[model samples]
Each structure stands twice: as structure tokens, then as C-alpha cells.
Target: MAPPVSESPPVETLDLWLLEAAMELPTPLHMLVEPNPHIALNMADDPRLSREELCERLSLLAERGLIRVHALPDGLQELFSPEEISSAIDARQSRTPFGYSLTDAGGAIWEHHARPDWSRFVNAGQEPSADEAQDAWVIEAASLEAADAEFHFHESLGDVHQPVGESKHGEVLTPWQVTYWKTLPHGYRLRYVTVPRPADPARSRSVPSRPPWYTRVWL
Candidate 1:
């Protein structure tokens, strides 16, 4: 018989941060526990976790099958439980590499906990209809705030064409920031959108915006 599923631990601020980091890239245990230049630069203000504490939490996630610990390069050939992987690292066994990646369950949990309202936003790939495309949309780009513009769909243009809009602050939106977007209703006004920061998971900051716009859109 399969082993019973372990109870999921309380999702702490740091745990969500770790899960997000692993999601972006399969992370080795050391990268999380030790002070690395990348982590130092990106996660400067985040709390520092000891190896033991990190391992314990990771073990819980593994036992619950929320995350998978496996051999690196290609994790399919060999898999390791959190404890087993931790022991290998402690022993300084370099022959085999280990890293963490979220399982389906982990991804679900992370989405549920981290981006509770993400479903409202439409993905960038899902282009608006010809009629809808004619209207301006509020786009959540890489930078903090959303941009109001009309996305293109020309044959030469790829998934998203060059967007043209009235200049407010002369801010430019990069291709990557054009990830998610939503339409603004006719009489609404644009207000601050709250987004969670990975560095400081506990607190949420507003997506900076200018004074009241013509229509309000929830991001």
C-alpha cells in the first residue's frame, strides 16, 4: 500500500518564497541556506534560514508530496526523499547532485496561497478578440504598475504586436511585462493594485499609479 500523505505544514511567508524560488529554477539546498551573491542581490531582506530549519521544512513538503527532491541535470532516473537528500549533502557526497522542484500538488498549493486572485487576469498569449483588441486594456508588465494600451495582432507581429497608447508619464513597457492583462470598464477608474513581494512575503505593496484615470480596473 502507498504511504499515507503527511499533513501539510502551515504555509509560512518564507515557505511560499522558497516555493516560488524553486518554481523559477530548481534550487539546490545550499543555494537556499548559504549566502550566495544571487540570493543576496534578489532576496537581500528575506530572513536567513539555517540548514537544519530549511531541511526540516523541505522534508515536510517532500513527505506531503508537495515538492520533489531528485538528482539534478535530469531528475527522472533517481529520486530522493528530503531526508535522504539532506544526508547526502551533509556527507559532502558530490557524485550525485540534488535539487528541489515543485510537484503538481506543490504548484497548486503555491497558486492557492500565493496568487489567490490570479485567475481574473488573462494570460498574454490569449489574445483579445478583434472587437476587444480595438479597446485599450490594462496590462500588468514587468514593472510595478499596469499600462493602458491597444495590443496589436498583425500577421508580421507575433503573439503580441506593438501597442500604442497616449503617453502619461513617458513610461515604456517591456515585452516581458506584458504577461497578464484585463479590460477596463467604461465608467471605472484606475486604482492601486496590491501585489505580494517575494522578498517581503508578509506585506503587500500597491502597484504605483498616477491620480484617478477615466476608468477603474481591478488588476
Candidate 2:
């Protein structure tokens, strides 16, 4: 008979897991309070944490200096004290949701505890390959369009004789051809075709011809 597979160990409590999620960026209170399918799949039990409980947890986290609460969406620059934040939540005065972000201490704890492994967690409901997870470069940008435009402007350049956006391997791509992308802690991990050199070797007569085959770069 085949040996039974052992179950994986739990990483941390649901509250701490939420802390790690906030470490990525400032998240709205509604997103945290809502039922996350990803978190539910990993945990043994999925409890619909009440607003009171959620606020209490946030207050506790804030008191410990692990997180900061803001009024949102304009109050990101202004942080609220634990007592004040809790009161605001309890009062339900604001029409907009509150935002939560990790403090320096919280970031430190996340770095110490979280692994850089992508296979362990799902990104956009799909697991990335080990190579992609390890080799991908993190890009910080306000939006995907901005990041894509910047990448093309910096990486794609050549003389009139040679076409732009053509990889060394002769694979031609447009400026906005971002094949794959995933969210990261600070920004995004994007995979796209890269042209290391001019597509036409003859344009640069002195340089030797490289091998023909396009390779994807994880940015």
C-alpha cells in the first residue's frame, strides 16, 4: 500500500495571517472583514469575523505598533491612535471604509516569518513556477499601465534599420504585450518578452549572431 501523505503545518493564527496581508500595502477595512477564499482554503475553520471582533483585533494590533489605521481614502497620511480608531469603528460615522497598513515592526515580523516561496500561496488563483517565484524582479508602480510603458521605453531601443520590440531570438512583441503578472508585497511581478539586443544581427555587422529563441523575463 502507498504511504499516506502528511498534512502541512499551519503558519500562524488567522489574526496574524491578516497582519501579513496588510504588510503588502494599506488595505481597506471592508477587504479584511470580508471572507477571503484564499485564507479560508488554508485554514481548518472559516469564521465570519464580526465587525466588532475585527475592530478589536485591529485595535490590539495597533496598540502593539504592528499596524496603523487611517480614515481613508484621504486620510492615508494621517494615522489614528488605537483608542481613536476603535472609537471611530464602533461609532460607524464615516461613509468610507477605514484603511490598515503595517508599521515598521509589523514589516520586520513578516520578513522574519514569511517565506519567499510562491508555490505555497496562490496568486490570482494560480500557483507560479519555482523559477518564476525565485527569479522575478519586483517592480513598484502606481498602476500596471505605467509599469508596462516604462519597461518598453527603457528596454526597447534600436536604429531605423532594425525594428524595435523584437527580441534577440526574432520574437516580435508590441509595447503593451505583458504576458503574465502577479501582485507582490510592494508592487508587481511582471513577465514579458525582452529584447536584449537588436533583432537584426546585420544592423550591427561587427557583433556575432546570437542563438535564436525568445526567453521570457520575470520583472
**Highest TM-score model number:** 1
- Model 2: per-residue Cα lDDT over 143-166, one tens digit each: 455445444443433422221333
lDDT of 2 at 3: 24
Report the error of model 2 at residue 28, Å.
0.1
Residue ranges of candidate 2 with Cα displaced over 4 Å:
1-12, 35-47, 73-96, 117-219
Task: Residues 11-94, candidate 1: write the lDDT tens digits.
Answer: 667666666666545666556655562453344344466667777777777776767776674457434455675674553357
TM-score of each: 0.45, 0.41
